[model samples]
Target: MAYVFLAVAIVSEVLATVSLKLSEGFSRLGPSVLVCVGYAVAFVMLSQALVRGLGVSLAYGTWSAAGVALVALIGAGFLGERLSGIQIGGIVLVIGGVLALELGAEHGP
Candidate 1:
C-alpha cells in the first residue's frame, strides 16, 4: 500500500538523519555507511509511494513533516540536543499543516 511505503520512507529518513549526526562529518565508518543506505531506502520507498497514486503534495508534506519531528525528538532524547519551546512549536505547526493538507485533499477542491 502507498501508506505503507510512506511509513517506511519516513522511518528510513529519520534513521538516515540520525546516522548523519552520528557520522561526525563522515569521519565515522559504520554510521556513515548507514547514512547512505538509509537515505537510499527512504527515497526508494518514497518514490514507490508516489508511483502508487499518492499525491506529491501530500506525500512530500507528510514525509518532511514527520522526518523533521522524529529527528528533532530523537536528537533531543538521545543525542544530548536541546529543543527550545519555539522549535517545538514550529514542529507542531509543520505537523498541523501536513494534517490540513491531507484533510483538504480528502474534501476535494
Candidate 2:
C-alpha cells in the first residue's frame, strides 16, 4: 500500500539522518556507509509511495515532520543532546500541521 511505502520512507529517512549525525562528518566508516545506503533506500521508497497515489503534499509533509521529530528525539534520548521547551513546542506544532494536512485531504470537497 501507499501508506506502507510512506511509512518505510519516513523510518528510513529518520534512520539515515540519525546515522548522519553518528557519521562524525564521514570520518566514521560504518555509520557513514549507513547514511548513504539509508538515504538511497528512503528516496526509492518515497518514489514508490508517490507512484502509488499518495498525494505529494500529504506525503512530503508527513515525511518531513516525522523525520524532524524522530531525529530530534533520538538526539536527545541517545546522543546527549538537549531540546529547549520552545523546540519541543515547535515539534508538536509541526506534527500537528501534518495531521491537519492529512485530515484536510481526507475530507476535501
- What is the number of backbone collisions in each predicted candidate, taken in the order shown? 0, 0
List the candidates' TM-scores in order: 0.96, 0.94
Write model 1 residue lDDT over 1-109, tens digit each, in one string: 9999999999999999999999999999999999999999999999999999999999999999999999999999999999999999999999999999999989999
Off by over 4 Å in 2: none
Residue 14's lDDT within candidate 2 is 90
Cα misplacement distance, residue 10 of candidate 1 (Å): 0.7
Off by over 4 Å in 1: none
For candidate 1, which ten residues in a row score worst on lDDT?
99-108
Candidate 2 residue lDDT tens string, 2-70: 999999999999989999998999999999998999999899999999999998998899899989999
